[model samples]
Structure formats: structure tokens, C-alpha cells
Target chain A: MNSITSNVFGPAKSINVARVLLCLEEVGAEYELVHMDLFQAKEQKSPEHLARNPFGLVPALQDGDLVLFEARAIAKYVLRKYKTEQADLLREGDPEEAAMVDVWTEVEAHQYHQALRLIMLECFLNPTLRGLPTNQAVVDEAVEKTKKVLEIYEARLSEHRYLAGDFFSFADLNHFASTFYIVDATPYGSLLDSYPRVKAWWEDLMSRPSFKKISANMTTK
Target chain B: MNSITSNVFGPAKSINVARVLLCLEEVGAEYELVHMDLFQAKEQKSPEHLARNPFGLVPALQDGDLVLFEARAIAKYVLRKYKTEQADLLREGDPEEAAMVDVWTEVEAHQYHQALRLIMLECFLNPTLRGLPTNQAVVDEAVEKTKKVLEIYEARLSEHRYLAGDFFSFADLNHFASTFYIVDATPYGSLLDSYPRVKAWWEDLMSRPSFKKISANMTTK
Candidate 1:
């Protein structure tokens, strides 16, 4: 058995780390999650960890010599590696559906992440860190911009059950991790409330057994 | 043989459209390119095109019932469908290499695009249409931001030939498309000259027969 070692410096409360843990649950994979203390600047910036990830980010995965960073990439790798029976998780039998899923994943990585990062930086990181100030103008612009992007999702979910059509794929899970984090922190939480279809979709996704397991794991730390 | 249709708008000089064309060449795939007259504002915002892409973006691909937008997604599809011998365009063999490629592509789509778009809007799009005068400060800031990013690439390429190591993958291609376009318009054109390894790598890529073919096609239109 090729064992995988996941080194995560983030708290279980971190949405980025939760994205990976949720992916493991979806794939039913058993792996070690080595928790690193971000407060102490322990494992993440350590020379060993930096060797694995030059960026010194958390949620780095190691399978023998195959060490990878990036939460989305690691999530996709887990899905591809473990979920042979779960067609909806990674590869789709229908090319079109698969492409749609890819599109949503890209959206999650690009537009969704862009908005979410700005909000997170303002609400959490910026105040405590060495970056730009959590200015109201920047936050407002981010919220407005994010709402515009989410409107597209709102329209899509109005017609379909999931972000990638009917299938509750990892794509939906990925978006949920980031979106729910922003909603949890920002006043723009009501944005989803206005989009009933998206709200329902969120509720449905969070209710999934895999989501439950991952969410439980997140709170435990 | 399945027929594919790609909607390419803006001027023939558009960098985004060139990305798609380059992908087609890499995959050795044949497709019909439908040029949308951006001046007339005719084809891009047309109802049919809008149906394929809600964002009303150019370089949307259509294959039978499958309609795909987002240039990266379309390029990935073309590579998967037509490229017989997978050359690790996105680093196929090793998990780490693949993940690195994926991360760089994300960086390109997210961070690099953000900076480059600012430059483009100020330098090319706004100026060409006689809109607001170009913001020199914004342009300068963007160039600095983009150069910092290139420094990361330079550091990586100094140690390894391509973005994802020795292999010339789609990650390199993605960066090439974005950087080449920005360099064409910026005083930062000479910035690339500072990174000898990256310059050599890029020169080799630009000299590829496939790249040559695509560039020729791009100019003739």
C-alpha cells in the first residue's frame, strides 16, 4: 500500500485545510494528517516543510517521492487516487459533464478564490499579519465583485442541483469550503440568503455524509 | 471525425485567442475559427455566443452538444482529446510535477491574469478605443507586480528548464502566452532579458514548429 502523508500547518478551522480533509472523506481514503502549529510557526516554515513546498504553505501531501502542494491539486489527486467507484468525484463518463465540472473547478480556483482571499485577508489575515489594511472600501469592492460572480452560480443552481449540474462532485465541495468560510466571516452572509437556489444547494451539500465527517473533523481541532 | 468550432473575438492580435490557437497546434487538432468583430460588438455579445458563455468572453469552444468556455479549460480539452503521446504538458508522470504545473496554471489564471489585465485595459484596450487616459501609476504598479512574479519563475527556471521542471509542459505554454503578450505592450519587455535561463527556455518554446504554425495563422487573420 502506498501510504500518503499530509502535512497541514493550518488549524482544522481553516477552510483551505478543510477542503483537503473533505476530499479525503469523499474518496474514503485513510491518511495521516500531521498537524503543524501555525501560531508557533513550527512545521510550515521549517526547512523540511519548505523543501516540500517552496511557498511554505500548508496542506502539502507526500506519497513517497511524489510531494505536492496546493489544496485543490491535492484534493484532485486524492480523488483520482482513491475513488475508483465514485465516477462523479473525478472523472466523468460523459465528456460534457466532465468539462462542466472542470469549468466549475476553474471558477472555484480563479474567481471564487480571488474574492474569498480578499475577504479572508481583510476579515482575518490582514488585521493580524503584515499585508494591506482591512480597508472598508476594499472589502466592499470585494463583496460586490464576489456577488456578481455568485450571481452566475445562483442562476446555474436555479436550474441544477449542484455547481457541476446534478452530480455532487468535489467541485461543489471545493466551492463550499471557500464560500461558507466567507459567509461565516463577512456581513455578505446574506448574499446567499437572497439567492434561494444557491442557499438550498449549499444546505444540500453540507448535509452530505462526507461533508458531515469533514466538518466534524474541522471543528475537532 | 467530430467537428469543433471556436469563437475568437477581439482583434487578430488578441493574446487570449492566440492561447487557444497555440493549444490547437500543440494537439495537432483541426478546428474552424469563427472571428467575432469586436469593433462592431456584433458576435461577442450576440445571443448565441452568450448562451455558450454567460460571461460573454471570447475563445469559447463548441463540439456538438458540448459547449465549453474558459480558455484554459478548452485548451486542456483539446490537449486531452488530440494529443496521442502525453508529454506531461501539465506534468503527467509524477504527482508533484503535475501538482506544480497545476499550481502555476492557477497562478497564471488568478494572479498573473489580474496584473496583466490591468496593463492591457490601460495600455491596449482603453487607449485603442480613446477611452480614459492610461493610468501610468497603475501600469507601473502592475509591471512591478508582474516582475515580482517573474522573479519567482526566474528562480525556478534558473534551477530547472521549465516552470514544472525539465519538461516543457502546458504550464510553460500558459505562462508563455500571458508573458509574451504583456511584454509586447510594456517597457518590461527587456525584463525577460535579465533571466537568461527563462529567456533560453522561452526562445526554445517560441521556435517550436507548432508555435510557428500558430503564430503564422494568427497574423494572417
Candidate 2:
């Protein structure tokens, strides 16, 4: 395990990849980004990359002998291995507080991320990446679902400063990469304004220097 | 922290709920089941229920003073709090092995579970719960996606006894509940048999006494 500088192989624009990068940045860990563009170059399906990640996903991390896929898993690995100042992302000592962090982390990924991904595909990716017209019906449905999830976030954020509690954790960090697109590049930026707490939460996330560095050129424009 | 017995609120038929029950059973943890049917009874939307989970979802957990939702989160809490012989489900001793478990756990949930959910909705829930006709189109797309994920599982299982490694872990456990429905109730039972390794892996999970106890009456019949 001499090679501590982990190699993160993923395209820069990928939200999941950006999440891994943000995690490393937050921990001040040294990492080299290996940009493998899955769509344009079809390099993800290459045999070498496939060897790294059987699913052929953009995010495959190599830390010495350990090669891992799934961006969140990689992030967790970083937090576990590196004892940086910000590495107490999961409340290492308290089980209940840690479980709360894990709870909201899953909620963000499973519910909020999926809904926002749908909206992004319809409103941003399809029209921009595939050169296809935006499907208003799909966007409308996604917006409805996103709003339902956001209302819950509003309630949670209104009480606590962050999703997990008074402290920021990976649960809060997980929201930034995807929701940033919704706030930055999509037609629904104003929706965040509807939930003031949620809006403030996003602003707080964007204010982080780690996220700012990772998302510097991440806008669709 | 004093009270160890947890109360899990969710319908008996829910896959996520069953997942939590299976984790509890695996650890031999004591829990009281409070059935809150989100669909038929609509108890999930009740003000009291919403207080537990603002997302208004079934599968809220009450353990002492802590209220947690998201079925996986509850399962993890049970694993963490209960130090039974089977509770080292995350490879607690090793960081590298633990990260592998987390990676595959996400794969099963995000990739395999989503596809299986869509297929179940089209082939089982829509027809059985809503009394609507099965949509072959949705099921077809979902089956295709599921097969792709299963291919990855087959490759992984060919090398190791479980998703994480030669030993069983939560990564393997996560697949049981949703996939059980697909193999038991849907028309796609034979699809699992297409991959011998995948079939054997599922057979091993199904044979577990913990899973068997929880899913005893959980059938479409």
C-alpha cells in the first residue's frame, strides 16, 4: 500500500465521479484523475477499463492493490483510509449519529438523485448530449417527483442545519453534485428558491471550497 | 441507548420492510413490527407517521429515542447495535474487504434493485395490487436491464462465493427481498436459472434460516 495517491478513473463531467473527487478534495488526499469518457469515446467498455470495473462505469478507483467501483464506495474508502481533519464524515465514534448520516445519504441517492437524474436526462442530457428534443412530459413528471422529495428536505433542513444534523456529513455532500446541475444548468433553478431552507442548504454546500474546485468547469454551458 | 428492542413500522409485504426484518433475524435481534400499510391504509401519510419519516414512507424504525427511516438504514442500525455472532456483516475487521462489500451493496440496490422493481411493478404489483393489466413493454425493458446486471453478478459469483468475496456479507443480503419477488411471483423465474452461478448464489441466500422465517408467508399466491 505504498502508493497512497489514489487513481480515480472517470470523466470529469460525471456527477458520481465529481462526488469522489469532492470527497478526496475534502480530505485533502492526493489523487490523480484518469478521465475515461464513457459516452463519446466508448472507452468504459474497453477491456482494460472493464478489468477495473466489471460494470464498465466511469468511476473505478485504484488505491494500491484495492481497485473499487461505485463512487460512493470509493468515497467511503477514502474517509476510512485517510485520517484527514475532515475525514470524520460518518461520526466515527457514535453509532446512532453515524446511522443517521447513512440514513439520509441513502435517501439522497435513492430518492433525490434518481428524480434529479431523470430531470437532467430530459432537460439537459437528451437535448444537449444526444441532440434530441426535451420531452416536456418527462420533465413535468420528474419535476413533480423532485418537488415531493424537496419538500421533505425542506422540513429536515428547516430544523437541522444539514441533512444528518447540525454537522455536515457525506449525507450532505452527496446532494451537491446532482442538485448543483439542477441549480446551475437546468430550467428549475427557481424551485430551490421555493424552499428557503433547502436553498440555504444548497448555498452552504456550494460555498465549500472542495466542491467549488471540483465543479469549477462542470456547468453544461 | 438502554432499550435494545426496536419497533419497525412498515407493511408485511414490502420488500424494503422484509429486508429490515431479515437483517434483524440474521442478528437474532428483538424487534416489534408495527404494520403501517402505505398504499391501502395510507397510514404513511398520517401526521404521526410523517413525524417519523417526513418522506411519508413505510419502514420507519423507532429504537429508544432514535427514529430512523429508509429500510437499509434500519438494517444497518440493527447490525451495528446488535453484536450477535452474525452481526459482523460488513467485514468489520478489514477496510479493503468492507469497501468491497459496500461497492456491491450499492450495485445490487441501485442497478439490480431498480430494474427488478420496475419489472415487479409491471408484472406483479400493478396487476395484483392495483388490479391493472400487466404492461409487457415495461417488463421487457426491465428484464433486459436485469439480465445485464445479473451478468455482472454471475461473473463476480463465479470467482467468489458471495458478492463481496468468498464469505457472505450484507452485499449479498441486499438482493434477497426484491429478487425473491421476481423469482417467486413474476413470469421471469426462469431468467435467474439462465446464469448457473447467479442461480446458486440466490439459492444460498434463500436457504438462510433468517430469510426463510421472514418470507414464510410472503408470496403472491
Candidate 3:
């Protein structure tokens, strides 16, 4: 067990940090959480943190001598290294099913997250960070863009139980953290209610014990 | 072999399509090309195309009963299904190395591509697609962002031969198509001249036979 002690660095409130934490929880893997003060101290920009991730981003994982960054990539490393028969995060060894997982995961990364983050940045984080009011125009435009992305999700969920066809994989997990912020931590939570199937899918993902645990640990600033 | 016949749908001229095509060539995999007219006809918006990818995005791939979209996902599928002993595109068996590969891959997807695509859209694609003049302001902003990204790449490349540390994996392959468009198809091509390490890395990747083959097949609209 000592051989597998991994340290994850980032503030618990960070959406990206929540992403990896959820993966760790799902895999039932034990890791040391080194919370960096991203907002107050700006520790993420420090030399120590930058050495772990050149970009100075959050949720970098250090497993023994192998240091890794990118929340999704760290999640992949966690899933691959820690073998759990009950955990189906990566759906390891299943080529076609896994490819489908990759498809939706990429969709969430490239399409959904980009639009949703804009909303979170403008409507939620901006007000908190800058001590300024939320920008309604920016948030509205983001909401409109996200609605279009979710319409596709609604269509897909209308047929399948999850993003990658009935099975719960990283595809759903990839969207878990940010969507949590959008629906729970931000003003745009109601936007999801309009898309029934998408709403149901979100509800289902939120119900997972793994996500529940991580959500509980999130420190609201 | 006919049972495994795969078809890729998108205009040969598209950067996304070029990504999947490059992966296929690298894996020495045989696949059918199904060109969807993105311009003039706007065939990608048709229902037939939407069934393949609900987002109505190009570079959707169909392999027998299984259909997949998202260029990176399709590329992953190609690497897995039609693997070559001569090349390890995914670095499949090495967990640490593979995780490193994924780190760089994510960086390209999340950081580099977004900024570079803005430049591609404003400086190159906009003029051709909409008969509009180049938007210098947008292009300049994107270029500045891209320069920051490439500075990190230049530093990384100064240490390692490739993005994911020395070996040319999917991490490198993932950036091949878009970087080509930036350096060749856009005016910002000369931007690489300042980053000698990045320029050398680009030249090295371009010399790969796989990339050379795909470059020849690309239809410049």
C-alpha cells in the first residue's frame, strides 16, 4: 500500500480538482490531498507547484517518481494503476465500449466544458473572485451555447441511460465536476430543468456515492 | 477484413478530418474515406450526418456496427483496433509513459488547439468560407495566446525530443494536423521561426512517413 501512496495537489473547491477526487473516490483509492490556496495565496503559481505541472494548473498527481498533470489524465492514471473489480471507471480491457467512452469524454472536454466554463467564470467565479457583479450578457450567451450542447445530450440520454450507452464510465465522470458547479454552485442550475433527459442523467450521476463524497468535501469559498 | 471495414466522414480539407487521417496512416490501417461537403453544400448538417454525430461535427467514423466521433476518440480507436508492432502510437502497455502521453495530449486539446483554431478561423478559414476579410484583432489575440503555449512547448522540446518526453506517441500525433494548418495554411506560420526548438520538433514530426502520406492526400479547398 505504501508503494501506491499518491499525492494530489489543488484546492478542493477547484472544478478540476473535484474531477480527479471523484475518480479517486470511484476507484476507492487512497491518496494524500495537498490543498493549494489557489485564490488567497495563489500557491498554484509557485515554483514548487509549477515544477509538478509546467502550466501551473491544479489537480496534479504524484504517484511515486511519476508526476502527472491534467485532471483527466491523472484520472486515467488512477484508474489504470489502481485495479478494482467493482470500479468500472475506465471499463478497462473493453476496446469498443472504451472507445465509445472516449468519444463522449472528448465531447465533454471539447464542446460541453468550454461553453459551461464560460458561464461559471462569468456568472459564479467572477463575482466571488473580483468582488464584482455577474455579467448577465456573457452568462446568457454561454447559457444559450450550453443549451445547444445539452440538447444533443438530451437526445442521446433519451435513448441510452448514460453518455456512453447505459454504462457509467469516465464519459459521465468527466462532466460530473463542472456540471456540479453549473447546477449547484452557480445561478444557472435551473437551466438543466428544461432538458428532461439531461436533468435525469445529471440526477443519476449525482446520486453516485463517489460523487456524493467528493461533493461533500468541496470547500465553498 | 471486410467485416472490419471502417469509413471516415468529413471534408478532406478539414483540420479535424486530417487528425483522424493522420492516425490511420500512422497505424498503417486501411479505412474508407467518406467526404462530407462542409462548405458549398453544407452536407454535415444533414440528418444522415447528424445520426453519425449528433453535434453535426465532421470526422465521424463508422466501423461496421460501431460508429464513433470526436477526432481524438476516432484516433484512439484506430490506434487500438489496428495496432502495429513497429509503432506504439498510444504507448499502450506502458502506464507511466502512457500517462505522460495523455498529459501532453490533454494540453494540446485543452490549451493549444483552442487558441490556434481561433487564428485558423480568423486568418485562414474565415476568408475562404465566408468571403470575409481577415480579422487582424482576433488573429493577433490568438497568436499571442499561441505564442505563450509554444513557449512552454519550446521549453519542453528543449529537454525532450517530443511533447510526451522523447518518444513520438499520440500526444505528438494529436497536434500534427492542427499545427500543420497553423504553420502552413495560416500567415502565423513564421511564428515558429522564433521558437527554434518548436520549429525543429515540427520539422522532425513532419518528416514522419505517416504524416507525409496524409499531407499528400489532403484536398486544399
Worst 10 residues of 1 chain B by lDDT: B4-13
Which window of ten consecutive residues has the lowest lDDT sum in model 1 chain A?
A: A1-10
Model 2 over residues A72-114: C-alpha lDDT tens digits? 8888888777645556887756788888898999898779998
Top model number, TM-score: 2
Q: What's the chain B TM-score of candidate 2?
A: 0.95
TM-score of 2: 0.95
Model 2 alpha-carbon drift over 4 Å, by segment: none
Every candidate's DockQ is: 0.47, 0.83, 0.84
Candidate 3 contains a number of clashing pairs equal to: 0
lDDT tens digits by residue: candidate 3, A1-221? 33677899998888888888888888888888998988789898999999998888898998888899999899898888775777777765888888989999999887999889988888778887888888888888998999999899998899899988888888999898788888777878898999999998889888999888888876353
Model 1 misplacement above 4 A:
A36-46, A92-94, A115-147, A216-221, B1-12, B38-43, B86-97, B110-126, B129-144, B216-221
TM-score of each: 0.84, 0.95, 0.94
Give every collision pair in model 3: none
Q: What is the C-alpha lDDT of each candidate?
A: 0.71, 0.86, 0.85
For residues A97-215, could you state the per-residue lDDT of candidate 1 as single tens digits? 66777878777776778886787778666765455567888888888888888788888888888877887887788886666666665556677887888889888887888777766
Instruction: Please write out the lDDT profile of model 1 over residues B146-219, one tens digit for every residue.
Output: 77666766787888877767777777787655566555654556767877776787788888877767666443
Give the docking tier of candidate 3.
high
